[model samples]
Target: MNDFWQQCSTLLEQELPSQQYQTWIKPLSLLEFDIEASTLHIAAPNRFKLDWVKSQFSSRIADLARDFCCKPMVVHFVLDPKVARRANGATMAGSVDSASVQLAAAADLTAQITSLNSTTSETSIGQQKNSAAAGSGWSGSPLTNHESSGAPERSKLNPVLTFENFVTGKANQLARAAAIQVADNPAVSYNPLFLYGGVGLGKTHLIHAIGNQLRQQKVGARIRYIHAEQYVSDVVKAYQRKAFDEFKRYYHSLDLLLIDDIQFFSGKSRTQEEFFYAFEALVANKAQVIITSDTYPKEISGIDDRLISRFDSGLTVAVEPPELEMRVAILLRKAHSEGVDLSEDVAFFVAKHLRSNVRELEGALRKILAYAKFHGREITIELTKEALKDLLTVQNRQISVDNIQKTVADRYGIKIADMYSKKRPADIARARQIAMYLAKELTQKSLPEIGELFGGRDHTTVLHAVRKIADVRSKDALLNRELHVLEQTLKG
Candidate 1:
């Protein structure tokens, strides 16, 4: 098996550019092979890489494995650091050769992997071979072997945020589950997981968790975790430095590419153009790309329609604001992490009052904690109320149905009277429905009150319009953007 892998390595060396092979393929170790079952177990250094390989080159690997091993080989790439460590033994002190350093790094990474999974094996023949490899100074660069020979620095990922740490609830369970399945095997179920929600709603967390899990599984994968903002920045930087080739090289070489805050890319035309090419490159390679944003991809204003069309070509999940129970759980978790104790009642009180945003909710808890600690007093409902008095006052400000109707009407180029008219014309009816939807969504108005204001329509009519608008907003980018704009106008 060792000789086979070395032979395969040599084949890959000839097939791929030096940088790519070094960066992605060099760290991989063949863990087990079942010729009868046509199964080959391979270990990757991280989940990012596993996702990359599975998305970008699993077929290629399978084809190569069959040709090399003279059988139909099913490559199972796992990101098991322990396997790598077991395959590559400890590094000797005072080793300066590049090969020795890689072996040492692989060994150290493997040890960390084993520590992460204690029930795994330690002593193995592969470890001995890795030790020998370390001593022989055979460390070759993995970057040169990539399909895209121009890749720049690899992306940095946060190790602490994995699938385990992400708390799932009614609001995020589906998104969490989808992310897990995607991480476990990219492009199998949901090729592109589109996670959308308001800010700080755990979209980034879910995608990062996927990356972490894949890495933990030890798949020799090429994973790229980036923010759309960073992508834009990189494109701009590349333009300024005349390094567009470098930019293309960095982005097009991923098996799994996770992008966050995609809304930031909506307005930049040149950036969007570059991203479109990058997107095509990854998708063409069958790589999985997960994106998260405060709004749906279609709703992202100022983006090219073609780019938006590509974004809609997969499953879309929305991470809603945590329900009351989930919010309380979040508060408790935050308190625990901060080493502060809070009674259940206090936690619920904070959760209920600060339902607007997750960041705001956490900020409120921190403020209460800080004030209580400063005053040498225990946390109580009364103290919590006092601490959040200003926020509560702001939340208590009433938004009227009439105000929402006027706001929607003004924004949509419709007469305010049209909202109360029995107009069956497409534009008028749509405008009236939007007014009703906005009233139901933005104001503290009952369905009956909203209907009464909209030409004596029934509460059910208002409810139906709200539901229809919500549904349409999910798939209709223009409608969603208009609705968002109307909501912002109303809030302002």
Candidate 2:
């Protein structure tokens, strides 16, 4: 079974990208393989993993099994705790089990955080008593009374998220500055700092950095960093357990709350109402809240208008995809953190090609390092090109007509639907024409295909838009400047 799994892994390592293989395939445990029945039973640690494998890799696994066994083979992916425990037991007896290890780490972290909370609660209690005697007002910390109430102190914060490690550029300088301000003066400046951007643009990293900063500044500061989906799940569980008061107390007692991907809260009415009350109580007591999403607050649908308005009340900033130079800086910084001496030329080569997002850039870098380490060769431009050939091809092909339209729409402050709309207003018309022109320039799609993308207009209309933009560019200074900037942005 181990031999068969190893062979399958080798085949997958060649077929899929390095990161994809490491993320999805390598963690699979081969629990049972029957040669006579030509059946293979794979064990996934949880139902989520089982479902993901079945949806994504079932057919591929079937094919690989047949190839290896020289017969038709069926693959079954099951979530079995016994299988998981057996696998862990096989990992060097006398060593700590994985579950035990995770629990131990969690326990240690909870103890450290509880100590901080205890001290802060003591301080706040002292302050409250002193203010009571003086007949003066007191803005009590939310964590003060909660510690005695026995609420859990759990933080899903990553240690690596720190201000010192975050790379800032023109694209994200404003957002970074705002994050720093909120971290330095929580609840005082930017009460609900709203950060939104495309995926992998460091929104999560920035929020975690703020949480880590707050924890370091004040030992007793109660902080919780949760994804919106997790929060929604907690809401459902609270309803199930009939512990709404406990849920309200736990959430409302935080000094700093960071919610990532708030877009997930859309259409969840009950969760929204509960969160509305929690949001109100937290803000009434001056607790800081920060949220991240893939879209602006006003643009998020299905959420209550009042909640959206509250999101917009604070400073909203977009973290754009990093510029080319900034990407290279990020790659170099990441390499340094890993103790890899990546050169400027090679980093530039990798960064120049992987223009999608920071995640792809890092994935490419990891592949390159693996290639270099495996082959015992120096890191160079030639090596990067070889390791990233397939990725580069995909990236090049991904600059589609749809992508160009969205990029142009986002740049011009116009709706994406404007491209297909019949409204002839000057701004919308010009932006639509520019999008058509960019489609003609950037993508390899035919005129009619581009026309179809833009509300079934004729090829001649696309040609006219392209030619009109070309002619106007030579004379209109402002239009030319806008076109130049737009082209640069799209190219990046």
Candidate 3:
């Protein structure tokens, strides 16, 4: 049975992402197999995990089990709480001093929490001192994987995403400070620090910095950061295979859980249901949970209200788009890291026009650097402009409301005149709203400008149209696909 499970792990490792395989499939244990009844019982950590595995990877598990057993076998996923408890005990028993220190820290954290609740006057000063004390004695292992019950436990912190490398600006300073506080104090302060922003913001980098800092402070701390989509996929597999218990155990055991793009959880009820449990368990155990999304909690429609409340209960921070000076600093800092010589003027030139997010700024800088290297040219404002001419053209293209209306109308098989017409039919209204949304997103048009263009409607109406389309795009997968196609077509 053990051999067959190992084989299954190998096969799954080939199929799933490395992190996904390690997180969901590796912890499974083959406990028993009844040949007569054709029943193969697999042990998971908890009910949540059992359900996750059953839904997610059951078919693959059954196929492989049949191949191993030489017949059709019924697979059963049972919760085995003792398995994880034993594994955790064994891992923590590597040294007596380590265990003692951890216990003392846990005790101290409990006391801090109590004091924080009971007293409000000196709480601020007390918390500051406690936070400093918590961060003072930080001597432990870097983030490394450990062999837990033959399944490796690991964290997904990108080594490059340290606080030292993160460029602090007015845009992300608060987020960076909050992340630092979370890293230093862990669950003691901001148990769940939620960060949200547009794409290309520093959310991913900041979260990685926190994990890296925490891992550095405490050796062998169980930290797991995963994408929300990956979490949903894991839930689906577990549900199919009936292994919710194992899923629960692994996730709930973490010292810190960082989930990125949490907005992806919209419309995935089962995943939300399972994650809510895992979240409760981790929080109850004083484990830190950090999440990132592209939008604010309230703005994220289609998600359960309970889950949004959980997200809101945390210290929610936004990483806004960087200003001109910050963008220039980012570009120059990134160039310095790569050992590339970039002048202030060139950096400024690149930053002035890119004016989106940090990621786009970095991307443009990289392209310019690459272009200079490939052509053996010196870096200058002119050279930068030449290198990024095509991109700049796209960025500088005044994508007017007229252009968007025409494009969306043509794509949706509607007449362009309808955009300017007071047509309130369902299909025409839908197309008009899509055009307004696209204009808001793809052009530099304001709500008033868009409203004026679309049948002289009010600015509030245009805002409503934009919000409605954005909400529908998130919930309607087919409409989302069509929007993607439309956006790509327009861009091309």
Candidate 4:
């Protein structure tokens, strides 16, 4: 059965690009080879991937089986958790497993956090009160009121997400530096170092890095890293359990607090109110706080103004999409970590096409690695191209100047015509400027070409719009978020 599946995959790899072959066909297994019945049962990781393979590559798989068996064959696909788990267990050297593993571990950690916070002895409250009066500057390792042992508490942070291994680029350098300062100095440097960006730009990773850093520096510190959603769940549970005091006590006593995706508190008034109190308690005691969101503090619409103001009171940083060189460097470094010496040419090829975020880049790299490993082929630029053909086609189609204009205009609630119109209303004109900037960023079109697309304007007009938006985005968080959304939409 293994030999039969190998033959089928080999044929598919030769026929399809690396990404398609690896993503759809490689995870499949020969569940059953019914020679007498002229049927072959195949297994896919999950229903979604199986459905994709069934719709897109089932016929080819059937044909391959028939060619190998010298008869007409029917291929059946099934979802098997056992098979999926086995496939996802593949690890990068010393790195965390696949996304599923990460999610499962995160859930377990969240449970531990809730349990630990609610179950602490009431006797620990005096310790926190005494410590609060000592000063919050995270200098030498200060003992927590609750922590009697000289051992570190389980911070529930991903140890792999450390600052040492984090890839730095202009996009994330500011956030990374602030995280470092907060981690090194704790409460004194940036009380609540807030990080914001589009999804997958490493906000979560940065916060976890801070927690991990502090956990190492202050072994006796009470450190907690949690998603805002988990924090909300904790609040709800505390309310139901009538254990708000313990909750408040546990949170307020922390030497450091790391919260990811603070935007999740939207419309959850109770959660916001609870978190505000905790924020005040921690900051007032000189404890460190770090937060992350998908946008700037002022842009998170349903969160309380007071919470937003607190978030802004500390340093706020943005992590933009990686530039071309940075993306290539990341690919190379990640490949090296996996013990694969990928060439710069191949890295460039993959980086040129995957411009949205690091996760997207990692996904493409995984596909390429899987395809190359499955087929025992050497990595090359042409191979990278073949592996990412589907993604390349979609990105090329989506990042066109016309698509950018349409996406930007639609997002701003303006008509598509307004993108090229001569209208100079504040909103419409701003939308036009954004479209022009995107056209320059996403496409290979020259300045003159972009200008021509924008109602036959001059190249200097396009360049000026590009320069102005580029300059303003660094200082204006709202506009920066808008551009990030437009870029993500265009890339997708």
Q: Compare the candidates by TM-score and give the number of the best one.
A: 4
How does residue 318 of candidate 1 score in lDDT? 72
lDDT of each: 0.68, 0.73, 0.72, 0.73
Cα distance off (Å), candidate 3, residue 274: 0.8
For candidate 3, lDDT tens digit of each residue in 375-428? 998887678889999999988774667778888888879999899898889999
Model 1 stretches astray by more than 4 angstroms: 1-152, 240-242, 398-492
* TM-score, predicted candidate 2 vs. hidden true structure: 0.57
- Cα displacement (angstroms), candidate 1, residue 200, comes to 1.7
Model 4 over residues 298-408: C-alpha lDDT tens digits? 878898998988998988888898765467667877887888866544665677677888999999999999988888887766677788889888877766888788788
**Candidate 2 clash figure, as a count:** 0
lDDT of 2 by residue, 72-111 (tens): 9999888666644553112221112322332233334334
Cα TM-score of candidate 1? 0.57
Q: Once model 2 is optimally superposed onto the true structure by TM-score, how far is the C-alpha of residue 407 displaced, in angstroms?
A: 8.7
The ten-residue window of minimal lDDT in model 1 covers 87-96
Residue 81 of model 2 has an lDDT of: 62
Per-model TM-score versus the true fold: 0.57, 0.57, 0.55, 0.65
Backbone clashes in model 4, listed as residue pairs: 18-387, 19-387
Off by over 4 Å in 3: 1-155, 398-492
The candidate, 1 or 3, that scores higher on TM-score is 1
Which 10 successive residues of model 4 have the least lDDT summed?
94-103
Candidate 2 has which clashing residue pairs, if any?
none
